[model samples]
Target: MDVVIAPDEQIGEIVADDIAALIAARPDAVLGLATGSSPLRIYDAVAERVARKQLSLARARGFMLDEYVGLPPGHPCRYSTVIDEDFVSRVDFAPGAVRGPDGDAADLTAACTDYEESIGEAGGVDLQILGIGTDGHIAFNEPGSSLASRTRVKTLTAQTRADNARFFGGDIDAVPRHCVTQGLGTIMDARRIVLVATGDAKAEAIAHLVEGPVSARWPATVLQHHRRVTVLVDDAAASRLELADYYRHAHAHRHLVS
Candidate 1:
């Protein structure tokens, strides 16, 4: 695990820098996209780079991390539409280059199987962007989720619904109770992973994710087994990390890393 503590405003740029470099080296690099407020800045940075001709995603393909089940097509909150508005609309990705699980599928099990197969056929994700929940979940894989699970439908925990209520006009009741998400085992398949987090609400989760033991209780902890994972967090989020000082020192001396 490589933890890099940066200012709240800069974390996105740092992640974006790595992404831009990847696209420059491999224009068609597959990206695993995450939703929610945590990744907005990164999207902005990538879009700006495209606007400035410093970067282009015309050939890149993206796969979203999760989607809310039963949301009507064109629903603003749907992950597919959200990804379109949040990132795809601002860049030059080819039409139909991005995909998300079919949250409205009549046969959700088949949908999950096809989604997984699609990812494998794309040669798997080159780099995955992720966000940690206040409760330490990643991609809606709530506490107690199987460590070896794959893409599938999951019941949203009450905590997750409440946390996401803001997106549904602050009405927790309006938040969907079910979602389809990539499992921890599936996320671990990515060649590289970049997780972003911020704010005091995420402090404890960030701490556990970076320094705690790997366990199903904290789904994001599963990433500890991934070979290449970079965790980018702001000061507030890193406040509870026991080795914050060491992480900062290592980041400062990152040039020494081969």
Candidate 2:
């Protein structure tokens, strides 16, 4: 796995732009996109590139990491609606190129199965973007989750609900307790994964992911077992690491050599 510590959001945008260019070059790019503040800058940069005709989302397929299970399809908190507002609608991707959990699916299990099948039919994800929860969860795969889990429903922990309540107008009661997420097995199937993290709140999780032993309790730490994984962070997010400078310098030297 590779670690990159950018000076600020601009450098983060640059990193995302490079990924956009990579996807553009390979028309069949299938991206696993994440929803949250961490990836907003990256999405903005990619959207601008698409608007300027520098990148094309045509022939590319998009997948979202998770969605609120009980929310209506058009609900503001639904992952589909959020992805549309934040990234998909702003870019030039084909009208139906994006796929996310169906919040309104009558048979939620079948919906998850179909989603997983669709991903498999498309030859799996080329790049999976991720955001780390303050509690070290990734895509709702909370602490103690099975490493081999498949697409399924999950109950939100109190911490997670609290963290997301701000989006629901600070009404924790309005936050949905359940969500549909791709399994750890499904996420690991991706050929490449890029996990983005920011803020001091994420420092402990970031440190554990980078230097701790492999464990399901901290799902993102499983990236250590992947052949192609990149962990990108801003200075604040790398605060808890003892070798933060080493990580920063290594990426710098590697980029220079390349």
Candidate 3:
């Protein structure tokens, strides 16, 4: 994975905006989207572009990475709510262009299969935006999750629930124990993937993911093996990275070449 250490959070947003622009230029772009505080700023940047009439989502499709099971579709914590509050309702994408696993499905396995099939029929994702959990998980694919998994339901670990508690009235117990997520195999199918992180809370995970060996224990580390992965980090998140200078130098070299 190539790393871009932005000077600050706003720079990171600009970097993310550029990535969105690149996706917009594709013939038929399918986007894999993540929701969390880490991605909010980038979403804001993209929304700004749309508001300014600098970009359009007319030809784009979005697929959410995961959704908390058992929540009503209108629940504030639902992925559908996030897409609506963050991007969908604000953008000009056509009806049905934004897709995700059904949180209230009576048969979750069937729901997952349907979600996977729809993504496949659409020709797979062109760009995926990700947010790394402090525990090194991506899209709720918790530690030790199988790399070849398909879309399915999984139990949320205590730490994950606690981490997400703030969104559920700051009560960890209120957070759903289960969520449906696209598998690692599915995520890796995207033509390009962007993982964004900020804050010192993510330092250890970032260090392990960028420098440590690829293992399911830290699912995001698998991106290190993918040729088209790009990791954007703020200074705090990059603090534990030993190869920070190497990344900066490489980015500088690329800038010069262009």
List clashing residue pairs in candidate 2: none
lDDT of 3 at 56: 78
Error of 2 at 193 (Å): 0.7
lDDT per residue for candidate 3 within 1-258, as digits (tens), equals 788888655654665576566766773588888888877777777777778877777778889999999999789989889878887887777888999899799999999999999999999988888999988999989999988888999999999999999988999988999999998888988898888899999999999899998899898888887879888888899999999999888877775434
Candidate 1 regions exceeding 4 Å error are 255-258
| Per-model TM against the reference | 0.98, 0.96, 0.95
Candidate 3 or 2, higher TM-score: 2
| Residue 138's lDDT in candidate 3 | 92
**Which 10-residue window in model 1 sums to the lowest lDDT?**
249-258
Lowest summed lDDT across 10 adjacent residues in model 3 is found at: 7-16
- Candidate 1 residue 185 Cα shift, in angstroms, is 0.8
Q: Each model's C-alpha lDDT? A: 0.93, 0.86, 0.86
Pairs with steric clashes in candidate 1: none
Q: Flag regions of model 2 displaced more than 4 Å.
A: 255-258
Measured on C-alpha atoms, candidate 1 has an lDDT of: 0.93
Which 10-residue span in candidate 2 carries the lowest summed lDDT? 7-16
